[model samples]
Target chain A: GPKVLQIPSHQIIDMGQMVTLNCDPVSNHLYFYWYKQILGQQMEFLVNFYNGKVMEKSKLFKDQFSVERPDGSYFTLKIQPTALEDSAVYFCASSLEAGGSDYTFGSGTRLLVI
Target chain B: GDKVKQSPSALSLQEGTNSALRCNFSIAATTVQWFLQNPRGSLINLFYLVPGTKENGRLKSAFDSKESYSTLHIRDAQLEDSGTYFCAAPSNSAGNKLTFGIGTRVLVRP
Candidate 1:
């Protein structure tokens, strides 16, 4: 099965600091997505990317959050001046199409803010 | 309100038993997907369905677009089947983004 790789399974950072989470989506997968999971809650959609542009983003994707995949490299999510609510497990997923297809998800990165 | 609502927030089943999990959607979904998240937080895609039925091993899934609901049935469950099951559906409201339900936590005991 195809896999999506997420860097740094766990990260702890101080509030108001900047942190970047990296994801290596499946090769040939054009649609990339980031999901946030708070403890004891469902994984919520944050953003989706395609053709080097943000195709869509959810309300949870704040102004401080940004995503980019440069030169076919890792898809990275950067949070500037992180807030307490930003502490959650972030899962990266990729798919060839948005409908009638399976989406591959990574192990997820757990972010803790103190 | 949850766009995708899942029933039975938690369920427990004995090994070799059978159970069914369901998801109801408020938004019009074009597709449906089911995933199992292990305790280690690894999400494994179990089923990707349109408006039809798919059977894979001991697991079977059915999606009804007109009814706006989907179901996953596990037959002959095993201990490893214990995990959080989530049903995700993508709607026209959000471009290419799947709305996930709160999930049903399942525990299989011997």
Candidate 2:
């Protein structure tokens, strides 16, 4: 099975600081997505990226958040001036096709903002 | 209201028993997917369905687009089956994004 790997499985940062979560999606996958899950809540879609551009984003994707996959490298999500409410586990998923395709998800990166 | 709703928020099953988890959708879902999140927090894809059924090992899944629902059945449950099961469907017609259910927690006791 294909795998999506996330770096720094656990992270702790101060509020107002910047943090970048890295995801290495399946090599052949073209569509990428980011989801957020609070400690005891359901996973919520944050954004989806394709062709180096953001295709869609939910309200949860705040202005302080951004995503980019530089030159076919790791897809990264950056949050600047983080807030305490931003504490959650982030999961990355990738699929070969846009619709009706099976997605492979990473184990997730747990971020904690103090 | 939840776009993807799961019933029986939690379940306790004895090893070798059978159990079923269900998801009712408020949105028009053309396809459905099932995943299991282990205690270690790793999510493993279980099935991808399209208005039909699929079986692998002791697990079976079915999706009914007309009825707007999906079901996952675990047969002869094992202790390793203890985890959280989630069902998700595409948020748009393009099937580019997904909306997930709150998930059903299952504990298989020996």
lDDT top scorer = 2
lDDT for each residue of candidate 2 in B1-110, tens digit (9 for 90 to 100) = 89999988999999999999999999999999999999999999999988999999999999999999999999999999999999999988669789999999999999
- Chain A TM-score by candidate, in order: 0.97, 0.98
TM-score to native of every candidate shown: 0.97, 0.98
Candidate 1 residue-wise lDDT, B1-110, digit = tens: 89999988999999999999999999888789999999888999999887999999999999999999999999999999999999998855543688899999999999
Give the distance in Å from residue A43's predicted Cα in candidate 2 to where it truly belongs: 0.6
Per-model lDDT: 0.92, 0.95
lDDT of 2 by residue, A23-102 (tens): 99999999999999998678999999999999999999999999999999999999998999999999999998997456
How much is A77 displaced in model 2, in angstroms? 0.5
